[model samples]
Target: MESTSSEYARFLAYGNQLIEVHIGLRDLLADLREGVVPAAELGAHCLAFCAAVTRHHTGEDTQVFPLLAARDPGLRSFLAGLEHDHRIIAGLLTRAGAVAAELRDGSTADGAARLRQELDVVAAVLETHFIGEEKRLVAVLNAIDPSVGLTALTDQAVEFR
Candidate 1:
């Protein structure tokens, strides 16, 4: 069977993949907080989450946001806000990663407490950023030329690659 999907659908799928990664990180953090995941694994998990978010945000800033801004000047303010959110999330992720790195064992009371708190903040900020982005940009994305070649953005942001 031949399947045809619009660029908007493809883009949304890509964005959803990033969101799912955030969700997975949230779950992992929750497990860490509950002592379900081994404490020693927390640092590696934090680093992986940080990498995924950096890649996703970099793709958006370099590819998706620039194209959208050029095509629709009215979106400039919204994109700016999103960019600001990205910076904030980046800081939170960095702090979380640092705290995670300090965790010698999941049983480390102070380090685990700090890392869990940092992850909680990251998850909250990410939730807000993702929802706001989808609300503001999904329709615009759908309206963009389907052949505009967003392969770089999608390739980097999507996990299945």
Candidate 2:
């Protein structure tokens, strides 16, 4: 089994990756807001951001949450809440994606305005969800046995697509 310290380090690394991607998405959204990104690329950028978030959530739901549930039944409710947040986030992503697809020519005043609104909703919810998850599970995750590794938690193979 991996030492608790080592596992904690790994969990922190994963958290950092999540932060990095979140910042990247925010930066892209800011560019979109500034009307700098071409309309043709907006959809792709949105898709990438959504994909990353989906992968992270799917990883938690399938790999991390299950383990946490099995290890501590008391966490079931908390995990369920996180899962609910995932669904909400997924819906928000879908909404944003549709808008992005419509922006094929470049951002218009109305489209940009609408997209900003959608992204704001996404960002608000995601910030809450991410913080709640870290508060509730980061320590538990770090204590998991090294034998039953958490590689799956950080894996992107099991997608939400």
Candidate 3:
């Protein structure tokens, strides 16, 4: 019984950490969208945000999702849906990064507007994805075995530049 409780605690921590990472990513995107980061540095900031999000999704796809799917066959379809979101997000990030680069290079007269649009789309999709993930997975994650080392869930902490 105590072992089961410990497992719940450990996996719950993983779920909480996942949400924390998502929040951090959202905040970074908000800063970029709001022009909180200097105009000159917007390109660099956008790239950094893109990288952070990629790392987080990659970690979940490679580590967390596999473990969960293996533990519960029922999660396979749900995990696949999340993976689909990741692919869509990856495309959006690439588009945003290209716009940012064009802006930095002074090659696009409307780069800022285009970037903002891309960011808005990214933000909307991300918000939906995060909410669905948190709602569905927190309870599922809380039931995973504690023996599955927490390191398996680590996504290399999100870094802000």
Candidate 4:
């Protein structure tokens, strides 16, 4: 049985992948500034990053969040906030994707600067959301045995409630 800490640790590692996207975006921005990374490559990277984010989010929304929310009634408000924050951040990423596509097409359009701006917006929102989520979820970690926690969290998501 994995410990509660172990499962949370796993999820936290997943969270870090989103951070990696932010890092990648910044790197791409640097490339854009230097004309080193082709716009097409950057657009593809952004799309892939977004896809990864969608998967991480699906697991959290469909599996992780439901388990945590059911077990902790006190977290209901915070959970709602988290969901809202996710939508906000996603919007920013969508904008970045648009700008990236434009850039990749070599359109004289103001894509590079717009992409950089949107990326910053999404990154800032995501940072705040992750901080709040960690603060709330950390206490629940280790509150139950690892096996029970993982099973309840991943399998049924409803049993915890």
Q: What is the lDDT of residue 156 in candidate 3?
A: 45
Winner on lDDT between 3 and 4 is 3
Q: How does residue 59 of candidate 4 score in lDDT?
A: 56
- Root-mean-square deviation of candidate 1: 5.2
Question: lDDT of each structure?
Answer: 0.69, 0.68, 0.81, 0.60
Least lDDT summed over 10 consecutive residues: which range in candidate 4? 152-161
Q: List model 1 lDDT by residue over 9-106, tens digit each.
A: 66656556646655675675566556676667767777776777877787788767876676678999999998889899888888887777677445
**In model 1, which regions exceed 4 Å deviation?**
1-34, 104-109, 145-161
Better of 1 and 2 by TM-score: 1
Instruction: Give lDDT tens digits, candidate 3, residues 1-161.
Output: 23444545656777889878888988999999998988777887898899999998998888678767866789999999999999999999999999988888878888777888999999999999999998898778766666654433334422221
TM-score for predicted model 3 compared with the true structure: 0.83
Q: Rank the candidates by TM-score, best first.
A: 3, 1, 2, 4
TM-score of each: 0.72, 0.69, 0.83, 0.66
- Model 2 clashes, total count: 1
The local distance difference test score of model 2 is 0.68
lDDT score for residue 95 of model 3: 94
When sorted by lDDT, best at the front, the candidate numbers are 3, 1, 2, 4
Residue 62 of candidate 2: its Cα lDDT? 85
- Please give the lDDT score for candidate 4: 0.60
Of the candidates numbered 2 and 3, which has the greater lDDT value? 3
Pairs of residues clashing in candidate 3? none
Where model 2 places Cα greater than 4 Å from the true spot, the runs are 1-40, 105-109, 145-161
